[model samples]
Target: MMSYQKFARDVGFIGIVQILTSLSSFFLLPIITKTLGAYDYGLWAQINITVSLISSLALMGLSMSFVRFLSSETDQNKIQEAVYSILFFVTVSGFLASFILYIFAEPLATFGFKDPEATYFVQAGSLLILVSVVESISLFYFRIFRQIEKYSYFTFFETFGKLLIILILLKMGYGLIGVIAATLIVQGIIFLITLIIIISQIGFIIPRFTYIREYLQFSLPLTPNSLIRWVTESSDRYMVTYFLGLGSVGVYSAACSVGNLIQFFVSPLQLILFPELSKLFDHNKMDEVRIYMSHSLRYFLIIAIPAVFGLSALAKPLLSVLTTQDFISGWFVIPIIALAGLMAGIFQIFVNTMFLIKETKPATYINIVAAVTNVLLNLILIPIPSIGILGAAFSTLVSYCLMAAFCVHISLKHFKLDFYYLDIAKSILSSMAMYFFVSSFTISGILELFEAAGVGTIVYLIAMFLIGGFTDHEVSLMKKYLFRSKVNPSTK
Candidate 1:
């Protein structure tokens, strides 16, 4: 088993890379929205969401299963074989996905957009599924190999490539098509590059049919659950597009853009937690697993609670400066959705624990129920102009809240573990104190953001310190990590 400190460092490395990418996106969004306008932005968003749905299927739950199973394998030779086999599975899935999209490209395109030109965007976006599948597989492999530095390298390259392409094309007056085209081009390039690097690192070999079967045995059962999760996760954009039209969808998508920035912090937590928790489960260390769960929940809520409240409070000024006036309508949705992200992030840590214990059935069941509820709520609420994008945001809130509660109930019943409510309450109280501190600043735009964030950080630190959120021993460990010299800066 890896040391908690080392595991944290690895997760932090990935988190920093992800945060950089997210920052780039946040900075670029206003430029993209202004250049494309509402209708074009909406179209691009709809196409992307549609492509996301397909890519979820293209992934077919194999990536998560790959991480879990690959981490569990002990033998070097067998691990190599398993990696090659999973690679083969993903390649085949990608091809199958691309072909299906090609066959139904026209129907899928026109069904949502009702324009023939939109077909081209759909076709282009469909290819991104294959690219993303390949890229996810490569990244998971990198994680298993402990190639932390290379993982960061690929992450930045992927984000940078997409950013550069979008900026150049948007400047060239390509509009929404430019956005979709840029995604396709950049993802393709990154996928190829990562594949080449991985092949070089491992020396690729073609696996036999039995190797494929071994992977599928573990991977295939998880697909329905993955599909259900994708639906629940991406349903908001699709629901808005279907019920509210392209323009409304764009507005909600803009709101979600800000919300997704929170994921830069959450994703690395999930990545680290999933494998780490799986290891604990494999060893039957329920006590350590509970401690990790409590710690993860506390840490994430501390970061996210203020983030949601502060960002929402400052959304108007931030959007005005970062994006055009057109995007200001999304301002109202930010706080609501940001709060949703806070709840969802806490939920994700606990939900992932179910996977560790192989209690996936309940997770799948409740998510399906949640997904259905979201679609129904969108259909009922979107036509009311007063609700508008807020309705879409609320649908997500309701769905995830329901799913989170269900997951917690199931985990308790099946595993006899507790989520440590005292820890959660302390984090929440600290975060709320921090939020109020940050929101008290009387300013607007970027300056307001910096000032508020600065005050909030100091206040959060003081509050955590006063509240005894960290043990003295934990603080000493943190000091050692920060001050000690090391050959690899990441390891420190």
Candidate 2:
């Protein structure tokens, strides 16, 4: 079985980096929002999401397939061939996708954004789509080669780079298009930097086209599955745009920004989990895999529930610091979206199990079902006067919860394993206790942040104990870590 303590340690590191990135992003958003205004901010969100969708097509599911291959296969030569093949495919696909998006930039910008000036912004954003694809390819290569330190470096640089450029452009009074252009410029630099790092580590010669062609037989099948996932995840933005306008999208985007902090938890966990889980499967260690998966589910719920609740409770003040006061109107959307994050976390942990078992079509069907549900819900609800953006948030949470439930059900059917439901139940109870404690009092701005946080921790711990989530053994470990104290041999 995977060592629970060591797993937690790795998760802790991932969490730290993700938290730092999210914290920096939180500060960065307000600067952009204040400089750009809601309409312009909404345009940026639209273009970014549009570019993301196109880039997903360019990726063609190679990154995920790469990790899966790397984990399952021990043949060094085969691994090298697969790596080179995916790299070639992504690079070629990136160019093609960028070119196509550029050709249709005008129509996309006009229909994509609520503002007329968004067309000017779209031309600049075309560069972002191009650079973004390159960056994604580079990131996947980084992870496959185990260049995590460099991955962290690129992540921080790419994030801060946009903030720096945005500040420079805003200072020059270049307005909205300037802000969009700044992001593209920063992304290009990051892409170049990533390429330099990868080439230095693994030589610059392109692999033979024949090698990538062979790998495509395996990778291409996953593209539809990936697209379904993206549709479920991103279609809401489009629906919001169609129904509510760009300005409403701006508010929703801001709320999602807060909610994405929870994704920070998921992203890094996936980075560590996928390769490890794949290796475990290859070795036929079903027991170990079950244990690891169970721990991950419980751990994520333990962290995500309280984290989302705290974020939701403190949303107004958090937004005050993250963006401007005007942006605070969307604060209520934070909780709904944060709940979606929690559901997504569960889905992330379980969804790969189906793939591990090679139930690809079933997994695809589940995702497609969820995406269709999200789209239909948005179409029906976005027109309702009082529901608009709030309806979108609710739809995401409901769909995600269903998706997670379906994946878990499929996993149970395939694996003769117990999920430790009692542990999960206890974690839920603890989370609810923490949430009520934090949400009861209202103080304005960042001051209330500490107030809620302090109480939340105390309540969470007490509830965890009361709910019997921890054993004496686990409690002993906590003491050793938190207090640096050695426990005496127990008198049994």
Candidate 3:
């Protein structure tokens, strides 16, 4: 059994890693925007969107299947069987998908970029599909095995390497093609390194196709889920490009990236929670699962609520410093999209119930409904000329809210999770207080922005304390673990 202290420590470590990974992107955004300009940046966004969609399709949901099937298994032969089965399938599918993308690059560019000359970018991005699939499967192996440190190391290396390469290529005046090539090269190198490490650790055995049927049975239902999720998350960028042009897409993408910082906190919890919960459920330890579920939701809100409030409070100033004036209007969508991201995080937690029960069809269905709603709403709202990208943001928020609500309703029918409404209320109140406090300050530059964040964090913590956000027992446990106390604190 994993102790609370150990779990907390793992979550904290991974959270820190995720924050650094996010910071890499945060740091790169300004340079990317300034170097490529709005139209080309939007084209960059479109290329990535295409890659993400193709990669998701090629994955066929096997990554999650790997976690579900292998998280608790101990048989080495069986592990190898599953591993090679997934690798073979993903490799074939990824390459085939990449080839198709490359062959149709012109049409895709015509449709997505409206400039056939940009076909080369699409073709270059196609190479990323195969390398990305390999990287994702390797990372999933790390995750299922609970190799958190290794996972963090490889992820950091990949992000930093890509950043460095892109910087060099951009400085050499390689432009958009330079950025795409950098991603492909960096990911390919990382894939090779990760595959070697995995083989060395597990020892090579020729893959048998024994688990193919089972893996496919488990994964196929999830393919639509992946596609619909893409629609909900990314279709807006395409719509913006179509209606308002690529510059609008660039601005919207930048804003959405800023708002997605909420994921920095929520994603680490997600990374840890799935395997832990899967193991617990496999052992039929429903009580521990319940505890983990409740605490995870409460803790996510504790961090995410304050973050959304803080980011929203400082949106304008933050955008001014991070993006060019051409993209500053993107700030209008940040608050809306940030809240939407929080709701999306909540939906992730709720959907875990479906996974634990091995009932993912409901999740796919829920997302289908949400994705359709998002697309329709965007269609109606974006053409208003007054609403454009803001309409897209609103559509995302509404769709995510619906997704969360539906997932909660469906999941509750199978199992009960303590929603901890009171704790959530406390978090909201604390965030509101932080927002009020931070908004009182006038932020003009990077230093002032940092000061606002520091002050807001302190104020939010105090408010949470005053409102009884943390239990006495949790406080003691935190102190003991943080200070490395030798005392054996009660885990109850």
lDDT-best of 1 and 3: 3
Global lDDT of model 3: 0.88
Query: Candidates sorted by lDDT, descending order?
Result: 3, 2, 1
For model 2 the TM-score comes to 0.90
State the lDDT of candidate 3 residue by residue for 1-492, as single tens digits: 677667777888888888788778866887789899888999999999889999999999999899999999999899888887799889999999999999999998898777788898888889989998988998889888988888888888888888899999999999999999899888888888888988998877778889888888888999989899999999999999889999999999989889988877878888889899999999999888888888888888888999999989988887887788999998979999899989998999889999888888899889999999999999999999989999999999999999999998987786678888888899899999999999999877778878889999989978988888877766566567767655445644
lDDT of 2 by residue, 7-45 (tens): 566667767777777766876787788887776787778
Query: What is residue 480's positional error in candidate 3, in angstroms?
Result: 5.9
Question: Which of the two, 1 or 3, has more TM-score?
Answer: 3
Provide the global lDDT of candidate 2 against the true structure.
0.75
TM-score per model over all chains: 0.91, 0.90, 0.96
lDDT (CA) per prediction: 0.74, 0.75, 0.88
Best by TM-score: 3
- What TM-score would you give candidate 1 relative to the actual structure? 0.91
Candidates in descending TM-score order: 3, 1, 2
Error of 1 at 156 (Å): 2.1
Q: After superposition on all CA atoms, what RMSD does each candidate show versus the true structure?
A: 3.4, 2.8, 1.8
